[model samples]
Target chain A: MGPIMDLTIFGFLVQDGLTTGAVYILLAVSLVMVFTVTRIVLVPQGEFVAFATLTLAGLERGDAPGLAWLLVAAGVLAFVMDLSAARRRGSRRGIAAAAVLFLAVPAVLAAVALYGIGASTPLAAKIAVTCAMVVALGPILYRVAFQPMAAASPLYLLIAAIALHFVLVGAGLYLFGPEGVRTSPLLDGSTEVLSMPVSVQTLLILAASLGLNLALFAFFGFTLQGKALRATAVNRRGAELVGVSADYAGQLTFALAAAIGALSGVLIGPVTTIYYDSGFLLGLKGFVGAIIGGLAAYPAAAVGALLVGLLEAFSSFWASAYKEVIVFTLIVPVLLWRSLAHVAVEEDHD
Target chain B: MNRRNKSACAAVLMGLSCLAAGSAQADITVGVIISATGPAASVGVTQQRTVPLLPKEIGGERVNYIVLDDASDTTTTVKQAKKLISDDKVDVLLGPSLTPNSLALIDQMAETGTPMISLAGSGAIVEPVDDKRRWVFKTPQSDGQMARAIIQHMTSQGIRSVGFISFNDAYGEGWAASFRSLAEQVGIKIVASERYQRTDTSVTGQTLKLISANPDAVFIAASGTPAVLPQATLVERGFRKPIYQTHGVANNDFLRVGGKNVEGTLLPGGPVLVAEQLPDSHPAKAPSLEFIRLYEALPNAGMRSTFAAYLWDASLILKAAVPEALKTAKPGAPAFRAALRDAIEGVKDVVATNGVYSMSASDHLGLDSRSRVMIRIENGGWRLVP
Candidate 1:
């Protein structure tokens, strides 16, 4: 047994829980958004987080980020697919637009990431470039791997998502190597609250999570584009008939997911060490949070993720060896409860 | 009478043809199983890179190395081992970079009557001198040896109680078991012990628990970059006591990832880590420097790793034993493999990168206390703790 639990220890554990929980919350929100829109579980959501951090570290080291080259590769694939699709349509009306979006954008980003950045580059710019490179990967991947299968069942989409997760993990290893990296902290010092030390990085994480969630809330509630996305989520065919392009909504949703994942990487990079495979576990934790909402409600998912963080924190204190087991075991009870509660509304549909 | 004479003639011809076939092929084959692409890639990649640098011609006979990637999976290791032994008919086997994979290989080695030099750092691979482990040997110092060094240093420093944290895996469990048994002999009590996963983002709770115990020192038994988190977390939480880590963090990446937070930490590692700092009279100095020079000459080799040295030492063992084995039997024969195993066992005081190995029937891992060096993290580099 450890020392008797005291208030100071409790305070520190809470702080640790909230900080990690915040990152999971961002992941959960993005997951919910992507799932509702595309009917895909977005299993590789954590790869984006891993890639963003590794790319940022690469930029800081003056090594050309590998994701930039990956972006270019994905762009080339998407471009070829677009050209073939256009040929089938018997008209080249949008050929130029497709070329610019699917080819030129990625090439430009890759060039900037490879040659423009250096160790002397400012931190903010480095983060921006990392996000841009990672964000570019999303829509191109959606175009190449997902859009053609858009009409498939959610089961197949989930399978495809899991496959994509593995590809990204392999690519991550190729880009970042097997070494784990920890970036320089965005905020370096700490302040004491109730005699418990709270790192500035933790504070930064909380603020970023709160701000991103609020922004997302406002986007979904007020903006016309947001409504279109919501419309697509409500009913894909209905939204397509009402002048909301399904392709546009899907791409936009993927871009949002990528952005949230990238931002989470940036915030969490300084707080802990991250490797190419680290995101799978982190993303799985967020998936647990999303499941707590039955994969729908935003607030419930956020609260569930926070609870996971707290439980992980406290459990690690008492039984660090079984922390993961305890955290993952949470989903079984939640699933059972949801199954019982929603039994009446159950209906079999693709 | 005519039928018996005809059968005798046929038997004589078959014996002559077999002798001719054995004499025609004079090359030796050594199969290497490395985890070049998975969780153990850091260790495997280095060992793989060292492959080309091994002796191409041992004892005037050509040596061929067939390297296969196990991807750090135990099942793959067994599959590859079978392929190497049954298909390739390798004379000896090397590596399978992780502990569990190495343990999985003992049965295959024993079944095939092959000698194996494992690069994994656990004593379980070669301990007990059982029928299965007799064919297995390893280059890395056992966790028990490193634990003894750390305990000796603690005793001399007047440290009474210690805190312990390690990864929740085979490697950590091995260290915990070894350290627990060894530390008890010295009357040093463990005030607290905790385990964390390799991919864990934070160890705040573990750190808090360890701090509350108020031990004289904290020892973390983990390897690679994952080992950095607990020390960094402890330092961030304002723990000023000395922290001891296992030899797993001897690589350059650990220093790069840990940065300033790792300063003043101490660990016991192979002599390869502080080769240049050793006294000139030390036996391992010259070979260690030679390994560093050769490894650094490779393009994009980065820093010299202890894991690579393990492979280099394995090569040295082969170079010394091949001639003896060749003297007894022809290459590509079961008799030749049996001879090679015996030759390796009889090897004595052969100088190489990590230490001078002296193998015997009872001991396969032939390094002594001279193989380990006390290291302190200072000024972003390893400093020999005098």
Candidate 2:
């Protein structure tokens, strides 16, 4: 008990917490964006993390991942759907564009992956290729699973998200067996900061997370497309009436969420071992952070995720067995406070 | 006419009796339940691979092995055990790999009056020799034995204080309990003790707390690839003290996942892990070499695992007991199970791949300090240490 309160221990806990918090912050921001624009929780966000890590590991071993094949299949399916829709709507140009973007993009990525296998590719290339492969999965997933049900009730979308999580988890197990894999660190060295040692990989994680957050801020604040997404989040029917394509906003949000999840996977793969089923728990922690922000504000979710990470670190030291319980219990207070502060209003129908 | 009919009746009766005697000497069926697809799959895979290497005929009786996957779930283990007993009518039961799965099937085994040779490492599987556990036996050395070996090594190194990071499961708690009592006996104080889940992504916080205690060494009581998490985190946080792991992680996957981080780490393992490196005069050498030869003969056999040797030893015990049991009662009968149990208990000085096993009414595991050897990870392989 006496040693638990030591300042040095506190500092170490903070460092550890922030390192993990950075990844959770990315996940929380993705969750907030996806929920705000689409009114659906991205339950399978962790699957992207697992796929990215596994893909990187496969590349390190000089083997092409099964994800390469999955991506191509999804791309082909999405293109077929788009082509039929365009033909029905008498838009020949749309069909041609869809074929190039969906079919050609995945075909090129798959070819690169096949060529990279058994070859000594650069690490940056592997990282970029894996991230792109996973991000490319986003639009296809939206077109297949969510786009048709875009106007469904939030409860119905939540159920669909959960179902998608199971499908991805089953697919992950089939693709990457039950064995856990760890990749070599992207940056492999440590340095002392204020008498505390920190690894270069940890620094990379912090920097990358900061960069992504800033990029997201700029994307949402300045770009016309970002404003359209914001308008949809504020009032979906109003945005639709104003000629902003709801489908585009939904697809973009999912794409952003997928990219964030994959990047988080690549960043943390070296820090911890990742298994096929590991993503669900990690994503749940992010969901907890999202809930703390009332599922609306990005900055609040980021701060909440950092707090969750810090609490997790400190509580593990104090009571390791109950650390999960303590971290999850935080949401109860936040929920109670929000419920008491805000008056209930019935949601408007379309 | 009467003499001719009488002679024909005697000949027919003799032929029927001979046929009955031949049918009584049929195959002995051993049902195996192992986790081939879940968290324990790494360990269970090796155990499963050993099944093909078992002798097809034990004492002139053809042995039929029925293997089922429990998926590392305790309820599934019990269900599989029940199905093997009632449906397959297996003469004896072989496994239910992990500790929790093995422990869960104890009652079911006792109720069914079938002998279970478990491959798990927990002492509770055979300890106290209660009515329920009397039907159960395990091949791996008990946690208590390995704990004492670690404590002795620590004492010889002049280590007075140690920290522990254990998994929050039965295996972890079992080691923590044994390690605590053994360290106390050796005058070593436990400075810090922490627990983490097997699926936990990061143990940095727990590891930092452990380092803050400033112990001379830290012992991690986790198994498989997950065991690498805490140790790696400790190194990341710059803890330069000696680190030790439990025998549960004595496999190639641990070394692979751990990479450079686990070099020079110490752990106690079965002699089979570093069989080639052991001295020729060592008791485990001959049997260990034979197991390696037979296992490696199979196409695509990757690396020799100590977990596989546990099943190999179980087969050895079965090989010695099957003949004795066959003499008393036919296979799959109530009397046959009782006889097999007694025969296994009566086995004496049987050299197995892991160690020389000698089971008794009070002792089911039958291995001692001779079964364990201290090992270190050097150059990505297990090195035998003095």
Candidate 3:
């Protein structure tokens, strides 16, 4: 508590928070991509990322075991298994069912590789596990959950996925036990040379991490046959009548979005630990980040995350503990204002 | 003649039988609560591997110690402590590690009246619990001691510029306050003091902020998950000032994570990470060297960690207290425990593999200002250069 308005603490905190915001921004944009397609809130997206970091850490540590090729083979096998199943189910039968399973594979592999195998393998095994899971996730989720949920209101499904994600994480912790989750840099002194202590480095890491996430979402939005997907989210019949293949658009959207989410998870290791139930926090933050960005604007969602992150950082300075509690509480007023603003604009239009 | 021979034979037989019984009764039972299957498992491995061996090295009559897994969960830890006391009926208790867990079970002291030694440095644990009792004793000095030592070193360096970073928790908060207060007390300025949550990945932003302040040194008070953040960020930014870390980083896990970045870390007792360079005559050498030798002989030990030494220390204290505990035991569970606690806490001149440990109702923490030997991590190993 330096002065009424001491910029010293505030300045540092804001910068710290902005970097945190970047992580949220990346996560939020990925979620928005999935929502845009199926309109179903997806919960497993964050878990995919959480598991990715674990796999990467394992690989870097040289304790993952098994040949790297084997993991790559596993990815190809899972992809084939998913596609063949879809092809068998009338090449169309249960998109949602298949998508759910695809999203789940990475988490399952991560749990097994971590607890069942322990730290026996090497870097290749871990990379294989991560690649196999990530490579398989996009193609499978697109074929399964997104394609099926596109025709229905997806709010319920999103809620169900969130619940399921927690259950899985809880079960993993129980099964694996929390004994071996602690991680260090995969390699030794070499990592030290890469880490920077200056504000510029901190800002860059955050921006890069956050920017990578936003770019993935942007890939889905303005590019990648956006016209075909938007038609289905709104003018479903007219878009189809013109030439949009609603089925493929739904598949591409979910696949693209889920891939980005999983990618973020892999990169998030140095940012924080990969806990069993880290997704719940990430999902909530990503959702809030999406809301902050007007729930649809990619850049806006990212900005919202940055602002929120800064706020969280400042609160930490005043009281080093309870940073999360203070920041989560602060979001209420901003959300309330935005909600009211939305209703007012709607009424004006009406 | 027959009467004389029979009497003599019976006496001889009786003497031999007594010797046999004495040899059989030589086994000792001490109890230790360690987190085997939880977040701290890496550190817990240290306790599991070292505590049981303390009895063997000291050549106690017979060493039988109970090692219970706390499962890294609090509720399970209390139940395990009760089990060790009631079921196993150990003579003395070593630890339930972590500050919070240690505080949780100190309540049992009222019921069991057992003499327990904890390995955590949480300052609040050592403070009077309403001044009625000092039953709870900690081996590591309170966070205040660590803070004071660091501030003194910084002052001696004549460096007024400092940067402080800590995780956001009770442990970190207490450590930060002590460090800052001591810094200010010594007429030193904390240029950029920043904190992060345990969940944060990088301390890059925080380090940069401190770098911007251009402090001559950085003091870190982080532990657990975010333990790697500051050093990693500091090294990454290539800002190679002298960094003083709290004893929170004594665990080798930080070195494993921090790697070559570990070279600059300054800690208690001068610098311990630079172990090889310590004078051959230094007291610290015997215990750590002996423990490492014993651990290396065992197949299941960790790559290398400070946990081994910490556990060895906790066990040696319990061994010093065991004999008096067994003196009046009735050879039953309840009576055996009662006798052991009474005997164990009365220990004096208990020189452990770590160092000489002496305790009283007034002072429980073993190490203080005089004990510190500052060292650093030099060329990928510990060399005492202080």
TM-score of each model's chain B: 0.92, 0.90, 0.81
Write the number of the candidate with greater TM-score, choosing between 1 and 3.
1
Per-residue lDDT over B1-386 for candidate 1, one digit per residue giving the tens place of the 0 to 100 score: 23234223323422322222234466787778888768788888888778778887888887766677787889988987886777667799989788899999898889889999999888888997689988988888988889999999999999999999999987788888889988999999999989999999989999999999989999999988999999999999889999999998898899999999999989998998899999998889999999999998987788998999998998888888889999999877889999999999889998887888998888999999888989999999999998
Decreasing TM-score order of the candidates: 1, 2, 3
Candidate 2 similarity to native, TM-score: 0.93
Model 2, residue pairs in steric clash: none
Candidate 1 Cα misplacement greater than 4 A, ranges: A91-95, A344-350, B1-24, B86-88
| Candidate closer to the true structure by DockQ (higher is better), 1 or 3 | 1
Ranking by DockQ: 1, 2, 3
Candidate 3 C-alpha lDDT tens digits along B151-257: 77777888898888887667667776777777777789887777777665434446656666788998888764346667666766577888888766766545655
**Weakest 10 consecutive residues of candidate 1 chain A by summed lDDT:** A341-350
What TM-score would each prediction reach against the true structure?
A: 0.93, 0.93, 0.75
Per-residue CA lDDT of candidate 3, range A1-350, in tens? 14123454455456567666777777777677666555666677666666566546655664552322223333355455667767877666555554444434544665665455545556545555665555555554444434445455455666656665665465545533342233443333322212322244444556567567656546546874865777665666677788887666666665566566655665455545565556567767777777776666777777777666776666554544555686577668867888887764221110
DockQ of each: 0.71, 0.57, 0.16
